[model samples]
Target: TIPACNANYLPEGISEHCPIKVTFVEEGLNTNKLFQFCNVWAKHPLFIDKVQAAWVKLLMVLLKKELKVLNTQFFRNVVAEANDDRMALYLAQNKLQADPMNMTLQRRREGEILEVQKYIIYGRDVLTT
Candidate 1:
């Protein structure tokens, strides 16, 4: 059966930060269950807020330590991909330069150049006027 929340009047400043209680009722079986899974209360409106708060707190604590636990492999992969892309662009440029009359090589070189540029600017948060 679908779980639902009953609107309970809460005191000011209490309900604002509190997660809504979700109750699941099984009809005919007369069984009731609180919706909680994976360390999160599914019925609460502030579930995501709580999780994000905990995450930020954990990140802050981690930042105080010397261990680089997060984004290490991700950054490494990005660097590796950038290096490979640069090498490919270099080879394409050389091939195009050597055979200037070849339209295919020229197109390939242009595509490689654009790809490299796109990769470099992939996640940059740039604001335009």
Candidate 2:
């Protein structure tokens, strides 16, 4: 939960209004969820406090590790699946060359190649961070 106060100065005798309240709820523990939560909290004004900043940094580190593991697994799975399809296409392309219907398979293989390229770019961005 976060509390935001409207502290604009008024006349000499004006009274301040009650602070606004904001609440965040997390349904379960996951790297992405935790990372987003930490990111939001870290940007809050109160995060300038030393203790809060330290805790947020700690959470960021842990989330980074978790996300890295998840990304690695996802990349590996995509590569393996793409390789399998490529092998299958290699063996079948010649037999199906005369058949116009096989264009779909070729398109699928191209899509898989693009997916691999995207993953590689994403991995590099993550690592450089």
Candidate 3:
């Protein structure tokens, strides 16, 4: 569960105590803004110690959160079950499409494609493409 404090400066119990409804804020699409906020927060006096380290960890979490959001949104209409191999291939394809210059994505897609080819060669009906 996400901590309420991490979300806003609201008091510990205030969110539960408040009678008014709070509209949900979509945070994934505005990654640049979120990173800027995290950068500023990391620079604050209270968070200054090991701010760089904190930023690294925060950035990882931020990235994961956004990626998950995007994956859900993008695959919402697709009925394919996301098993390990399928997820790896899907992520590799997405990365390749998003940034063709990324060598890692290229390598990953190549590896997945090779695996699919091997599976078909071995008489396994596990892969369609």
Candidate 4:
């Protein structure tokens, strides 16, 4: 979307309308290229302004279109499930500390600690070693 430094209209060959040729120069390099873009892009809210401001700094879109899907997956897989394991591990550690002989609390602590460790290994936002 760089600004065109030169423009010319060529004589119509087969079509009724003349073809517009635009030239762009960047840092001493010159180019004459034809750009083909999707019509849907023209419908964007900032279409006109984005084109005009391209010379200032070219910036574009990201995952803004489907953020809702990502939010659900991230919360369910990384945040909510990891928090559940953390809470269970915490309870198991406290109960085991009170009655060190209890086999049930010992087993629970082992299982929950493994689950929390899996989250840690996967690089999730959980308490680290």
Question: What is the TM-score ranking, best to worst?
Answer: 4, 1, 3, 2
Q: Which candidate is the best by lDDT?
A: 4
Q: Which scores higher on TM-score, 2 or 3?
A: 3
RMSD of model 3, in Å?
20.0
For candidate 2, the C-alpha RMSD (Å) to the true structure equals 22.3
**How many clashes in each structure?**
1, 0, 0, 0
Q: Please list the Cα RMSD from the true structure of every candidate, rounded to 1 decimal place.
A: 21.2, 22.3, 20.0, 24.5
Instruction: Give the per-residue lDDT of model 4 (tens digit) for 3-97.
Output: 64777765332223556887865556567689989999999999998888884453333443355367566655355667677777767776876
**lDDT for model 2, on a 0 to 1 scale?**
0.51
The local lDDT score (0 to 100) that residue 4 gets in candidate 4 is: 45
Higher lDDT: candidate 2 or 4? 4
Provide the TM-score for each candidate, comma-separated: 0.39, 0.26, 0.32, 0.41
Off by over 4 Å in 2: 1-48, 77-129
| Model 3 CA deviation exceeding 4 Å by range | 1-83
Residue pairs with backbone overlap in model 1: 20-44
User: With candidate 3 superimposed using the best TM-score fit, by how many Å does residue 117's alpha carbon deviate from the native?
Assistant: 2.0
- Candidate 1 per-residue lDDT, tens place, 1-129, comes to 456445543211111243344455544565678866664475689988988999999998879453333435445545456556666766876676578799998788777766667654787412111
Flag clash pairs in model 2: none
Pairs with backbone N, CA or C atoms under 3 Å apart (clashes), candidate 4? none
- For residues 20-41, write the lDDT of model 3, one tens digit per residue: 3345665557655443455566
